[model samples]
Target: MRLSMRARWALMFGGLFLLAGTALLLINYVLVNEIVPQAGLFVSNFAGGPGVSGGATVTAPPPVLDKQFFQKGVEGAVDTFRASAMQKLLIASGIALVVTGVLAALLGWWTAGRALRPLNTITSTAQRLGAESLDRRINLDGPQDELKELADTFDGMLDRLAAAFDGQRRFVANASHELRTPLAVQRTLIEVAMADPTATPELLRLGQHLLHTNERSERLIEGLLVLARSDQGLVSRVPVRLDEIVDAVLRSSAAMATEQGVTLASDLEPRVVMGDSVLLERLVTNLVHNAINYNEDGGSVLIRVGDRPALLVSNTGPEVPASAVPALFEPFRRLNRERTASRDGAGLGLSIVRSVTHAHHGIVYANPNHGGGLWIAVDLPLLERTMTSLSPRPGADPAISRG
Candidate 1:
């Protein structure tokens, strides 16, 4: 089993105590063994030993001198006493050592838990955080130690991130508002030019082409703005009927699908998601539009809305590689040379879908179709957490930015 840092630290503490205790016990045993023998413990004395000759009485070197000896029974008794004493010492000390070691282990566990509590706070905060919640801070309070420093550093990083997001939101807002006015003026001029009765056929055709290009730019800009808005965050939470939105997208996409010889089909259940209504509509529209536009002639586009995933859009067209699936959602990142040649798309369809999903705190992914094309799945929650109210954009829908 994989051990957590706290567990490993606790075990180390317990092991160290056991090691020291065993060493101390060994030293005590050795000391008692050596000192008891020298202390004359259980010594006994006797008067005589066998004479050197067969019948000679026991004698000393001189008349006044005497000799002492230990009987075999006396030596045996001393050995037995020492052995019993050593055994008792070991038993008593062993029990104490075990008890203390257990206590040491419990103390170590508690100490480790306290020391690592800050890390748990950091982990939980990181897990709960997202782009939308970058404003959150750890603000961990304690002594000015390593953990506190880490928390302060983390808070600083969040501060910088929140500022950056705010700046990007501001830039997108200003650019969208400023740029839309001129484009609107150009569109007016183009329309007025095309309405002239005196205009020649070639002039009319040129005007029409210019008008088409201008509209394409407008859409590209609009898609970009929407992308920024979604990236900034989800605006609000209202009960949005997802199936109804898909139906509306399908109706609007009917002409494009017909022009491309593609069939638009749907199997939508009554699924209501908690998200911005405009964002939800844009997400569905982008998917349906991309599906129809990217498919082959006489191919089919299917939109399925259900409880689990919320939305699924699949089409039959070009064969996309497995390795290229990740790039599909990236802004302006398209597969194949033909993708750049598409006239209607600003190449922000899937990108917009991604941003919208992120704003709603949902999951979006895609896989290459078995035969051809791609299948995209958007998984959104039917309910959402508390959301903040966002200020409305002056003259357009929720706009997006490039960052």
Candidate 2:
């Protein structure tokens, strides 16, 4: 049968008291029965000796007197001794049993609480955890002890679970929104083409529209797959120069900027970091694409890389509201003001950039630019080898020195 913690403790302490108290009472009974009677007989014999009684008692008193008196005296003495011993044993045993039982009960209760504290914490934390508070954790102290180790392990599991759930939610939301956009466009074009049967040009336009929608859907699917793989830790990583990556992104984005009538400029410096080159390239590409797509015609975009292994992409555009910046990194969340006629995206660009940056142990943040644009910053730690080689040494290689 399953017993509660308190019940188990009570049973344990009660059993111990029973065993101990029974043993003590038995020892007291043995001593009273044998030793008390023998000692009483010896005392009676000594007191009934010759010349010990008064003249009224006559010579040595009668033998009957001695026998009867000794017998009576011994009987009374033994009775009194037994009574006293029994009284003392009862009092002492009662106190001892009470004290022992109370102490044991208290100690048991305390120990039980200490033992189950981790489980209690786990229960409480689990109860409080939900979609909005997945990052909450149990306050386990250290890993050296057993319960603490278990709590830490549980917290780690929660961390992974929360990440998995969040990723899944983002994937579903982004996929639905991306799919919805192209399908809506295709439906609208089809209706227009059907209604205007005499317009051959309109039919051709609708055909082109379907092709574009298909292409967009395909790209969205590809991006979704890339994000899923990154979340699954499938991306390969290696040391790559951040400067070179920035240069490549700049070159690629420059053509797009020209087509959009936006100017692209870069102020990149030499910096190395360790990460997946393809994912990092995608990260930068998404940021630049977002900047260009959201910018006004003749807008300017600036890219910067620094020794701290930071990348900043700022474009001249309408400023996003402060309240909306936090949601910008979330999938399928677009700022109402930035939803212009020229902008076209599945709204997964920033989400992808944020996820990839997180996988690389980096942070990306978006804020309003000083003038009238949005600024996105990617900050990562420099490569270990690069940092080590940068440390100053006497007569070091001039080529390796910081420019």
Model 1 is weakest, by summed lDDT over 10 consecutive residues, at: 394-403
lDDT agreement of model 1 with the native: 0.80
- Candidate 1 lDDT at 88 equals 99
Structure candidate 2, residue pairs in collision = none
In candidate 1, how many Å is residue 101 off?
A: 2.2
- TM-scores for the candidates: 0.80, 0.50
Cα lDDT of all candidates, in order? 0.80, 0.72
lDDT string for model 2 (113-209, tens) is 7777777888899987654457789978755788888888889998898888778767766876787687678767666765675868767776666
Clashing pairs in 1: 225-399, 225-400, 226-399, 226-400, 227-400, 228-400, 228-401, 229-399, 229-400
TM-score of 2: 0.50
